[model samples]
Target chain A: MLVLKPMMQKTSAKYFFLMPGVLWILAFTLFPLVYSLYLSFTDFRLGKEPQFVGTKNYVEILGLDGEGGDDKALETATFSLFLTLGSTSMTLIMGTLIAWVFNHDLPMLRQMRAIITMPLFAAPIALGFLGVVIFNETNGPLNNILQGLGFERIQWIIDPWGARFAVLITDTWQWTPFVFIVVLAAMQSIPEDLYESARLDTRSNWILFRRITFPLIAPALGTVALLRLVETIKILDIPISLTGGGPGAATQTYSYYVYQIGLRGSFQLGDASALSYLVVIIAIIISSIYFWRVRARFD
Target chain B: MDAASSLSSSIQTTHSKPGYLPGTSRIGRYLLIGLAFFFTFLAISPFLFALTTSFKTQTDSIDGTVIPFIQYQPTLINWEQEFGLGGTETFKSLRNSALIALGSTLIATILGTLAGYGLGRFKYGIGNRNLVSWFMSQRFLPPIASVIPFVLLFRDLKLIDTLPGMVIINATFTLPFAVLIMRDFFADFPQELIEAALVDGAGHFQTFRDIALPLATPALVASVIICFSFAWNEYLFASVLATKEWKPYPMLVAGSDSVRGIMFGFVTTRMLIAVTVPVFLSLLVQRYIVRGLTFGAVKG
Candidate 1:
């Protein structure tokens, strides 16, 4: 009885500690999640009872109804894909380059690293506002510098492609440092002894990097790439502030489109909820692949 | 040669293995440094331009003024308008931001620490790995997925546009991150101390409150800084949930435009105000920022 009592106390004590967090998640996160899923099936609107429509929202969104229902979702999904691919590629390439540069034992490189990473911490929406100033077509410094360098000025904010480019630049600038920091850490973690042993066989630094550094850091790069891919798909704030989904919906990302449908302009809560689930599902699939692939690496 | 000298020489060779580029000359090193500095400038150029814009007249900013006193005259009009004693709106948002951020951070850190400690130390029949994954999956769930439910739920509870409402949502958003970090921290904690305390008759909570919590300061600090910064920088929920009374600084920054198509000078100041906390906190938590960001996948 005494031994059982102590075991019971220990077991209950663990639950006691976990109780608050579990309950909080139940009420705030899990409940709302299920509720939103419920809302997705209904024609939910503010001040109107959510009438269950039975897969109508999903069908219209998926165009299973055959009338090209919600073609806008397709358009926005395409834009989201473009932005995701563009931003992820640019961020990965630039981040790897910068991290490689900063990995060296150079003067003030640490300080340079610190300075470069500042953008990662800034709010994306705030960066979007800053992007407006930076990408200002007429008098923006970017175009000013281009013209000064004898290149034709690019219409950064007004044109569709230009606005898309601006969003890519802003998201890349903000997230590149994330890759930089993570990759830099990965690079630094490589034991010098590996290089020491490799140096016996090769004097070519390129070969050394290819043979020794690249393979070791490939996992880190892969992880950063996956993280960036997931994040860029949900790009909303930058488009909201930088382009306002302007230039005829050129910059309208999937999330921004979902926001418009759910919250703004007639408040189509059901459709928005349905759209949100699609994104959630996509994100889950991406991360699940990532986790499954990397599960062997983790304990 | 002595073994220590050989070891030191090997270390020196590793240290001197020139940068990514194959360069041994002093000129090459300096050139690499310069290139690095240029990239650094490119990274921070947005903030730099914004800082200059914050100090410039509206006309000066739109004129693409790059250098202060060279291309255009700078002024404090923007700052005076947004942050001077008369800027009640900005002040209210700042206050609301601090209160909401701090309130949410407090809740997330405390609750997360307790749960994280349990998850870290105890083995459960359900599996800690599964529980931790469940916690972390919440972090990746699209905010849009929950915003509707939150709006409807908060409306019924009279929580929309309230400080507590913002705090609750922000805390919920940041809780998963907090758990991931603190769980990793406690998992790596020294088991001897915990075992000793248990042998000495300290209850689980007692050992946690005294031994684990105090020793877990660095992780706690990292979690707190991360949670606060995330809560502070939040905008989507702020824009939707907070109409006027609980408007956060990000909304103020985002909404800083007039009929003149995005008042560049005013918006710059608002952005600077919005980013200062995060920029400073990032520096303070630089060591743990990577870990916190990657949800403890990286032990950095």
Candidate 2:
């Protein structure tokens, strides 16, 4: 039954299947990545030749060159960090609660879960457009509901803190379902007999969660948290749509800042490339930690 | 949750409920139910508001009238303006979006599946594990980092604002997701079938095509869904590359704001159109959502 193909023929088949993907990645990702790295070191613009400046762009973006450097980058970077922490924590806590609440068997839950998860797929830019109306100080449903509840109306889009809150809540609403779904899957994977045995030892729900549920689901939570953190750090679309970095740049995120410098304003391609590399560095650091932890668990 | 409580109460009034702990008071149960409903409302409220706003007139939209007939008269002017005869830009954008998304998804899925199958079934000089990790790292590369180079490159090739160009870049970023997920799927596939086919004198490609490909349909479909959505929702590259006649619908939605502030009626219509495309296709991917979202990390 051993109808053996030649070794040379087998190797040809492998390359025939694999070479297209490799070529595509080379043409699109690796070449452009290297090109952008070169761009980051030059003084490039839309209509001019790129002259290599050798770390000047990085120096200016890092605010080490005080003359031409902008402090706004630092400010936006801080805001981005705050937004990442704030929104990621909120998404995690809310996701844990919702997933825990819905972990049990229920009627129509399958359908409800589909509905709840819809926002995960919605376009963030579109959500931002809707946010303008939803968070409208006057004649918006959110403020109207708050007034009905005997709370003061907020200047959601106009005030600085309110604009920040608008971005935060919008992001949380969009991503919490991700955590919910992953955590729910994790929780459901715990053996039923394990929980049954634990119930025999404890009459308190909190104790059962602390002893059985939390430890079992902790890894899943950590993975989701880190994933959400990375995504949040790169946020650009919602701020573009919802606030447009308005109310005195209160909601300008780091990605938005990079876009402003590179594409929108002076078309500073060099600085933009440098800024982009900075983000890449941060992302690489975080993802490295994620890989180390997650790969260890999987192995 | 309510169902769990009822099952517990009906059983022996004991502490043996599998999911629910021994003691959840009636108020606690009610609170959980309340929280669930409230969150469910919060989850869909934006879409709900967009739906109503799509049907509202400019004045009535900002007037805070939510109900259709009682509070305000619903109108089709917004929808008509967008989907009707005067909506040439909208029509073109929708067509461009569909073409780009479909074109990229087709290319990425085919290429990714082949590479994934090769990686899964064969040994290579660079180990399959390292190759998979390389692809995964590509998935994490920030689009901003590449946008400038892409802009310059596309301009030089005269590929800017063209459907093929958009397809190339989108397929680039989305290709990683397809590769990673398909690799995971193929890795976990049962291998006895391949050996049987080989023993029957079928060549490797024949086995992969006739036997393995059919069995890998679910993974293929999942990869297709994910790649399609990522391309469809792509905005950054589209924003820079497609300047003129080839602009996608997301650009239209993001640029819907008029000089006189946001025309709520018009913006809402575009917003709904942009969102409905992916959300509608999402139902087909319900089972694959967790795995797809996490890039097949935590398999559902």
Candidate 3:
């Protein structure tokens, strides 16, 4: 009896320690998640009684069962995909190149690296605001520089393609620093002997980098790419702040689209809820692929 | 004689390796240095431009000049107008943002620390790996998915437009990150100190407060800064949940576009104010941030 008493007490004590956090997660996270799932099945909106629709919302969104799905959802998914690919690749490439440069001995390297990463620290919304100032048609610096160089001012914000480019630029500017810092840390960890031994064989910096540095940093780069994929698809703030998904929904991302449908436009909670579930499914698929790839590497 | 000469050569090579410069021409080195400087300048140019423009008058900000200080006198009209005595809306929003951020950060840190300790130290039938992974997977759920339910739930509870509402929601999202970070930190904590404290008959809470909490200060600091910045920078929930009474600073900055043809000076000033604390905090704990950001996937 006494032996069992201590074990029970220990178990209870652990639960006691875990109670607050678990309860917080339960009430705020799990409950809301379950509630959202329920809401997705019902035609619910603000100030309206929810009716059980039985897969109608999902069907409409997916275009399954011979019904035309929501075009907005498709558009949002396409935009998210494009932005994810564009920004992630750009950030990865630019960041790795810059990290490679910084890996060399340079004066004021620490200060310069810090300055380069400052953009990552700024809020996405703030970056969006800065995007506005930087991409301004006439008074902005980019246009001013163009004019100074005898070039015509491009309509950066008003035109559709220009607005999309502006959003991509802002996203790239904010996230490249993240990749830079991560890759730089990974690069710094490689033993100097590896580089020296490779250097003894070849005077070509390109060959040395390709053989020694690239292979060493590939794992870190993969991790960053996976993380970036998840984050970029769910991006909301930059699009909201910079272009407001403007020039007629040219830059509307997945989250922004969900926000618009769920909260802003007509308050279609059922459709929005279903839309969010679709997003969750896409996210899960991506994450599972990442996990599979990572596990394969380890094996 | 052959053995001694080889050993001496090996030592000399090792010594020279530390001071060895990679083979690059002087011009190439100079070019690389220039490129680094150029990129650095490019990264910070937005901030510098914003800072200079924040000091410009309405007319001066719109003038066709690239340089603010060179073209016209710098003025404090925007700052004075927004942050000075008359800017009640701006001040209120700032205060609300601070309250929500600090409140949520404190809650997330304490809860996460306790949960992390429990998950790290105890064994359970469900398994700690399962629990920890469950907590982390919550982060992967698109926030908009949960946000829809949160909007409805808050509306029913009359939590919309309330400071506590914002705090609760922020802590909810930030909790997963906090738990993941704190869990990793606790898992890495030296076992001997904890063992000694327990062997001396210290209770679990006492051991946590006296032994574990003190040692986990770096992680705690990282958690607090991350939580605060996230809660502060969050806009979606803040926009929906809080209205005129409890609007956050981000909402104020976002809503500024409505005030007549993109007021550059006003917008820039608000943006600078919004970003200053997070940027400063990030710079201070630059090393620890990667762990918090990556959820311990990539150690700093």
Candidate 4:
């Protein structure tokens, strides 16, 4: 068998197989990433010859320029951070609670699970449009029900806080099911023996959940939260569709602000690139903490 | 016999649990079921409202009635406008989306499967772990950071607003996911089958083609569906890279908001059409989603 084997070296063959994909990543992903980083240092506006500006864009964006700094960029970063924390926390709590309820064997459980997760499949752009209709103050069902219940109808899209709330609600709605599905799957994977022994000791559901379920599911929840954090920071479609970054710049997330600068507005490609690098830095910091905490379990 | 006894004992222990005590637990279970139904309703209500409103005429959609078909007679006008003879732009956008999604998915799956097979089966000086991690780190690069370069690069290549260009970008974005999922699938597969094929004098390619490929049908389907959904739902690249000639369905739906100004009927109609295929496919492959979304880090 050894004598009959082909003479091709397995190591080289593996490299041969990996060549196309590696090249694709190098050309499209790595090359572009490096180019963007280089562009961040230059005055690379659309339709103009690039000139090396040497940190001016970064300085301006960071508010370190002698000129009173970019207030809107700071505001956008704050809003993105706010939205990330708010949405990720809400999604995790609601999803875990709902998953606990769903961990039970019940009639029509399969179909119910399917219905709950349906929004996770909807395009975010489409969900944004749905938000427009559902959160419409005048004729939307939400305000209509509010009025029907003898309460004054609140302006959902017009008021600033109202607009922010609408975006948050829509974000939570679209993503909670994601957290729910993953957490539910995690819960189901817990060994039945752990639960059985815990129940043998105590009839308190809370105690069993705290002692056994929460610890067991902590790693999975951490994974889900980290993923959601990265995703929520890049939220663009929902806010764009919901309020177009609002009556003011109330809902302009960091990515949305970058989109406005780079693509839609002044076409400040250099500044946008610098701003994006900042966003990536923030994401790396946050994810590093999460990974460091969870490293022990995986090892 | 030992396994059977353990299983029976586990069942006995479960049944004898104090938590299962009579009417109290039964009532608790009912309450839990009620809560599940409520949350499910909340989850589905927005889309349901959109669906019902899609069937309403423009006037009826804004009638301020929560009830559909009862508060007003449902009409087919919206659906007609979406699929009718005059709906060329909408139809064209849908076609563009389908073509881009299908094209990218096919390319991603093929490239990803080959690379995944190498990483999963072959041991080398560099090791597959480093390579796999490098592939996954691509996803962490925010889209905003790359969209400008892509726009410029695509323009230089004269590939802007073209289906193939969009396909290339989409495939690049989805390739990490596809590679990770397929690699895990191949890693989890039994090695004996490949060994047996090797003993029969099959080369690496021959073994992959005749033995490994056939057994990987489930993973292939999962990867294809996942890649399709990512490409289909993609908006940022599509928005920037593709202009009118190849504007995808998401762009069209977003365009309608500004161009048509809350034409609830048309917006809902376009949205329903845009989401139908991906949503249906996702439900079918729901079990595989956790694995794909997490880059095969956690099993569903």
Candidate 5:
């Protein structure tokens, strides 16, 4: 009975320490999430009661302009899906390359690395807008320099492909540092004894990488790529601030579309909320795969 | 945009191996070096032009040619104007930035430190990892997706255009990062010492306040720097939140960004003010930051 009493007391005290966080998340994170789902089915404006109109609101949005809502959902879904894939692949590839490049031993590499990663700190809007400043048609340095070098200036931020490339380039430059940091950390954590053992057999670096480093660091890379995937998809600041969904909606990503509908003009609260849920579901599916892989790796 | 410069050197170390493959020959090395220079220039050129333009006479910025590093006459007026040393909106933005940065840092640091200590040291074995993972997920979740919902939420709460609103969101976003970092630092501590303190009649809070907090000073500083930089450069929430009187500095930088169109003098001058907070903080805590970031990433 004494043991039981003390054990109960200890357990109660432990729960005390944890309650704040659990409550904070439940009220803020979980509550909002549930509310978002509930509100998705209704025709609720910001100030409205979030009327329970069943799946009608969802159907209406999915069938905007009498075009059958499923088709709209399918169409936007394709574009977002493609957008997600493009950005994620770019972030992963460029990030890994940046990590590799920065891993070198040059006298200037240290300082150079700081500069290379500086773009990550610059506001996304700043970087994207800077893209226009440098890549714009008039007096931007890239154009001026190209023209001076006897080459023609490419429309870097004006054309659809050009704007897409601009976004790809900017996102890759900013986020690659993130991957570089995580991968390098994982690379460093691999036990040196394994590499030393490989070297006794005169194993080449590539062989060492394939057999030892890749597997060892694979977990961190997976986590990083997953994190980047989620971040890249909903990213809006750069697209909004830089492109503003302009040039005939060519560069408008999903989040920007959400903002345009939700906040910029008339409030399509139901449609916007539904769109966000769709976003969450897509993110969950993509990240769930990575999540399972991560668990498997740990297991 | 929360890239910590302290991290740049660590990755470079792993890539500097002397022994290489058959392909790492003279041509390859040169090619790699050339690419490095190419990117290095590509990265810094905008800033260089911005700097030069800031010094150019406002007229020269747009009209002048960017020669080989020495085309324009230099002046300090733009810097003065930017830092509010010239007494313009630059002063207001600079002041606004520092106030928000300091305020947000103070709040986030205090809350995160307490939360970190709680989550780190006194695990009751009930909801630790689940809570931890939940916190970690917030870091990756796109702020954009959350922003619309939060805008509705914040407006309802009357938090829009207010310092507290921005601070709340900033702290909320930075919490997972802080907890993650502080937990790593706490996990590195000797479990035996904590146990010993418990044996000596130190209550949970007492043991943490006396022992863990003091020992975790390095991690605390790193957490503060990270939180501060995050709050400083945060744009979306601030742009949405700060309506008129309560504008944070980054919003001003975003605004100033468009005003200069190849006009070097004004743009670089404004950028200097925007860039100083991060660069200054990074250089100040370079040593602790590298250790902190590496520890947080690689350890539990």
Candidate 6:
């Protein structure tokens, strides 16, 4: 691996482009993350006069947080799970539905596709936070709808589940198109004959779907779900913007916990890094699972 | 959607009338249309409400009871304040956002185009796959992992909440996409063109500048639009990295700290401003998106 073969040696110009990217990622990305992991294990809260309290930070944040401690890990886990599950499932379902709509051959289909993808393109913090204002309980547009439907306007921001659902709805609205775009592309690539052959077996559209459509799109669907899972897990802005993971940590995702600990509320840099390291480890594992499946498919 | 689906259904029938019942096909079509309507509604409701809410007066926004389709008056009060005709915080945010997005996108494009060319023409063996995948993975690296790190890094560097800071962070993410897209376009080019330039005694840089650059115009335009829109719409990194005074446009609207049910006119105006640039850019590049998608697998 250390030996530079002759072919590699001649590539001075090529190395220039690739190296900068590698170095940039290393400096701002790989090194920082690794540093964060190291810090996670230390007693590194701001103004605490720092110490090497090995594994104390991790244990504390992971729920064995000793008495009178924050119990942050326990608080964080429930909310993160709810958040991850809610956002992921909603995006997957909506994404597939939208893809099916966009898959049909139509003039301006591409334009519509781009329009659908617009939400994801919009910065999450801005659009997502703005959505919070729009969905506000007292004067939120959603309550207006609820009221109009012959029901009482309910508390949106006040309830943990309601806020969580609002975050999910907005995220789904934004990201469904991502899955849609990829799935539509996969659907387009599918051999038409496969669908036609399914048609030969039955005229029932349910049969056509059960036997043909769903199975064929499974890989794409799975890929999108996996991608959404990894992306959704890191979400900080949307939940933070909408609910502050509020109504008592109902929406506080693990990533948001990292923010709460590291920067904004507490400034517990060491604890935050530890929490983030835990989050990264989980993300890595999830991504590995996705890649492992993808590899198996190719093999 | 219904009209197109029906026509396509007829075409499907013509290709070969399947053994299915006629009633079920129609029902299937209706179900699909219903689902499509629900999806489209879900997709556009945010925009629609944002549009309507932008026009609502302070009273109406606080009341928050504006009904859809029927009932309720739409006002232009919010829009006015946002445009500064009504005198509000709207214009300031918009201006800050535009400067940062434009500044970052331009820098990212230049660096990326060069990097793309380098990757395309030069061949290297060791760590190539890992390197390429690493670049792609960075695209999906989940913003959460990097946001905190960047906040700490930028603060120490004293670049927080500034346009230059936002531009640099925005450029890193854009760099990978720009390189990947441009590199693929380069890979598709015939080597003969470059060889001929070399035979004509042009130096490597000159060959790339005169020959390759002109030919990659479509790709350049596409990648530029993509990088620009991404920078324009960037929310998370900018939110953490830049505060309001130096806030990028998207951060202004999607701020995590917005006071609940505040200004109606201001909100609408910001929404319009936040959405306008990227929407316009996407429309301009709409023609190239499908072709550009192939960049994922095939390299130039």
Task: Give the higher-lDDT candidate: 3 or 6.
Answer: 3
- Which of 2 and 6 is ahead in DockQ? 2
**Model 6 Cα lDDT, one tens digit per residue, A52-123:** 788887666544655554566667766777767877787777676666655554444544555565665566
Stronger candidate by TM-score (2 vs 6): 2
Error of 3 at A106 (Å): 2.7
| lDDT of residue A19 for candidate 4 | 79
Error of 2 at A8 (Å): 4.1
Can you give the DockQ of every candidate in the order shown?
0.55, 0.51, 0.48, 0.51, 0.34, 0.33
Chain A TM-scores in order: 0.95, 0.94, 0.91, 0.92, 0.83, 0.87
Question: What is the two-chain DockQ of model 6?
Answer: 0.33
Give all candidates' CA lDDT scores: 0.83, 0.83, 0.82, 0.82, 0.63, 0.66
| lDDT score, candidate 2 | 0.83
- Model 3 spans > 4 angstroms off: A1-10, A65-67, A289-299, B1-25, B64-69
lDDT by residue for model 4 (B1-300), tens: 234334323322212211211223878988887898899999988878888889887788888655755687888898888779888988888899999999999999999999888778776466576677667767766788889989889989999999889999999999988888788878877889988987797877888889999988777877898899879999988888887899999998888788788888888887888788887776666666777786765666
Candidate 4 chain B, run of 10 with poorest lDDT: B13-22
Worst 10 residues of 6 chain B by lDDT: B13-22
**Model 5 iRMSD vs. native:** 4.3
Candidates 1 and 2 compared by DockQ, better number? 1
TM-score of 1: 0.94
Question: Would you give me the overall lDDT of model 5?
Answer: 0.63
Report the alpha-carbon TM-score of model 3 versus the true structure.
Answer: 0.92
| lDDT per residue as tens, model 5, B129-191 | 545556556665555556666777887899887777776777776666566667666756787
Query: Model 2 over residues A99-153: C-alpha lDDT tens digits?
Result: 8887765445566677788898888888898898788888788999999999999
Clashes of each: 0, 0, 0, 0, 8, 11
List residue ranges in candidate 6 displaced over 4 A: A1-10, A47-50, A63-70, A105-108, A150-152, A289-299, B1-38, B62-74, B85-90, B140-144, B195-201, B235-240, B254-261, B286-300
Model 4 residue A229 CA deviation in Å: 0.7
Docking class of 4: medium
For model 4, how does the per-residue alpha-carbon lDDT over A1-299 read when each residue is reduced to its tens digit? 66533545565677877878889999999888889889899988888988999999988877686787889998888888889999999999999999888877777765787678778878898888888988888888898889889999978899988988888889999899889988887887786777776667889888978988899889889889888998898899899888889879998888999999999967888888888888878777765655555333221
Worst 10 residues of 3 chain A by lDDT: A290-299
lDDT of 1 by residue, A19-59 (tens): 89988888999999899999999998887988999999999
